[model samples]
Target: MNNGAVIFAANVDRVARFYEVILTMSPVYVEPGLRVIASDRTELVIHGVPPQVLAPAASGAAPEPREDTAIKPFFVVGSLAKARDMAPLLGGFVFPPEREFTSRRFRACNACDPEGNVVQFRELLVSAI
Candidate 1:
């Protein structure tokens, strides 16, 4: 089955640039409030969300943002180090990469776009023969 994910961004263009650099792929589609970037047949859609929709109510009667409601998209990268280095340059923050027992050949890192959406990147380790 084909896999895809959508991320809401305050600035669609900015987030699109960030993913373009990390994925090494230009956006295949772009519009006023939307951008779609694809790599290896998988698509990542960045949608611009209006400030009013994301802002607290004028009456100060809004619930705080919840971690459980966040959308985290995981990406497989050719080089974690390169992606990590490029993240900050494109207005994104890259956490240090770590190897997990569940991911034998992958070193993963969590990164956030300027809009504060978490995106995970994983690098496949070369096998020693």
Candidate 2:
């Protein structure tokens, strides 16, 4: 089975640049709206948002819950604690780091990207050893 994921967001260039600059990923394609970033075997595709389409986050005002279609992007890091420590570097706020399952450490954090996308980050440590 192939376990693959693709997150489609409004303003693909902005989202793609976030990963490129912050995550240090270089996209295989330098297209205007479509780009693919790969690390080892895992890849992420960022496609441009169509015109006249309002992003989920922009469709509502503050104090209201994010819409149902809002995307919460998750990426596993080498150290949950360390990743949490670096949250501020990406303009992110860590929710609180803790062990989620018997075998992993996890945390939920959110960042308000320049394009107004609510980026949710989940840093997980697979094993303590």
Query: Candidate 2 lDDT, tens digit per residue, 67-93?
Result: 355566666555545555554454333
Q: Could you give candidate 1's per-residue lDDT for residues 24-57 as a string of tens digits?
A: 7668888899999887668878888898865322
Where does model 2 exceed 4 Å of error? Answer: 1-3, 55-67, 70-73, 79-103, 107-120, 126-129
Q: What is the lDDT of residue 53 in candidate 1?
A: 65
Each candidate's lDDT (Cα)? 0.71, 0.53
TM-score of 2: 0.56
Q: Which 10-residue span in candidate 2 carries the lowest summed lDDT?
A: 58-67
Clash total of candidate 2: 0
Which lDDT value does model 1 have at 34?
A: 96
Q: Give the TM-score of candidate 1.
A: 0.78
| Pairs in steric clash, model 2 | none
